[model samples]
Target: MQEQEVQRGVLALLQRIAPELEPAQLDGRVALREQVDLDSMDFLRFLISIHEQYAIDIPEADYEKLVSLDDIVAYLRARLPTS
Candidate 1:
């Protein structure tokens, strides 16, 4: 998968988890939880959604690495199989 694709997928999952999020207003460098005001459960759901959408395993230990949009995109880009 490409970077844009990964980014879109992340944004989509985030939107699903937090419908009030405005994608255009989001800062890729900022923490997602801070931007969207996501609680622990919502954040967990976001990770689960990413795992389900990409068919990849996101181990609990790596959760801290996915704090921002940039981080999530980089994480997914590194794991997703290329076409």
Candidate 2:
């Protein structure tokens, strides 16, 4: 998938997990948990949503690598299957 597509998917998933979040206002470089009201469970749900949406396996060890929007996009773009 393209970078924008991955970013959009991440943002959409984040919104689902934290409805109050404003995707347009989010700073991609900032940590998602700090930017939104996501607790550990909510964050896990967000990661799970990503895995379900993209069919990518995200082990717990890699969770720290996905702290920001930029990170999530890069990580997913690298792992998502090409068409």
Candidate 3:
């Protein structure tokens, strides 16, 4: 998937997890939990949403690598098969 598409997907998932967050407020480089008030459960839900969307298995050990919007986009992009 394209970067913008992945970003939009992340934002949409985040909206479900934290409705109060505005897409414009997200900093690509900042950690999602630091930028938002999402707790551990909320964060897990966000990750699950991403996994569901892409049908990609994100192992628990790699969860830390997806701490930011940029990271999530890149991580998912790399895992997705290029068609």
Candidate 3 TM-score, true structure as reference: 0.94
Instruction: Spell out the clash pairs found in candidate 1.
Output: none
What lDDT tens digits, residue by residue, belong to model 2 across residues 30-59? 998889988899988888998899898999
**Of the candidates numbered 1 and 2, which has the greater lDDT value?**
1
TM-score of 2: 0.94
Tell me each candidate's RMSD, in Å, in order.
0.8, 0.9, 0.9
Report the alpha-carbon TM-score of model 1 versus the true structure. 0.95
Best-fitting candidate, measured by TM-score? Answer: 1
Each prediction's Cα lDDT score? 0.89, 0.88, 0.89
Q: Name model 1 segments beyond 4 Å from true.
A: none
My TM-score estimates for the predictions, one after another, are 0.95, 0.94, 0.94
Tens-place lDDT per residue, model 1, 1-83, is 88887888789989998888889999999988888888999999888998899898999999999989999999988887788
Cα deviation of 61, candidate 3, in Å: 0.3
Looking at model 1, residue 61 earns an lDDT score of 96
Backbone atom clashes (below 3 Å) for every candidate:
0, 0, 0
